[model samples]
Target: MFVRIVKMGFQPDKIDAFFENFEANKNQIRNFEGCLFLELYRDKNNTNQFFTYSYWEDEAALENYRKSDLFLKVWGETKVWFNQKPEAWSVDKVVSLE
Candidate 1:
């Protein structure tokens, strides 16, 4: 499984808009091919910081979603709300915990 974690920093003033966009697009993103799981997280101390955690069948599947129109539309709207550049990680599980 391929895991993806994206940390995003939003402008405090733009937070509401950011969530509105997320609410509007999250399902479509989750429904994309090879997407196995999707979850959203917010910082405990810093409300403006958020993270997207998801699982894909593989890197290619993640890449395919990145290339899709949903990503373009979502990202285009999302970046404008950022206080800083987002950071992303693609990882593989090395240990099992279940």
Candidate 2:
């Protein structure tokens, strides 16, 4: 499986709007092919910092989702709210305790 993580820093005032946009389109994103799981995480100490953690069947599957309209729509709107460029990483599972 491929594990993908994306960390985003949002402008304080734009946080609510960003979440609204995400809630509106999250289902469509989760329904994409080869998507095994999807979730959102926020830093307790820093509310404006959020992270998206997803599991995909493979890198190609993740890439396919990235190329889809669902991604474009969500990202296009989300980008405007960012205080800084987001960071993303993809990695293979080494081991899982659970």
Error of 1 at 19 (Å): 0.8
- RMSD in Å for all candidates: 0.9, 0.8
How good is model 2 by TM-score?
0.96
lDDT of 1 by residue, 49-68 (tens): 99999999998999999999
C-alpha lDDT of all candidate models, in order:
0.93, 0.93
Model 1 lDDT, residue 6, Cα: 99
Model 1 per-residue lDDT at 4: 98
TM-score between candidate 1 and the true structure: 0.95
* Candidate number achieving the greatest TM-score relative to the actual structure: 2
TM-score per model over all chains: 0.95, 0.96
Summed over model 1, clashes come to 0
Error of 1 at 42 (Å): 0.2
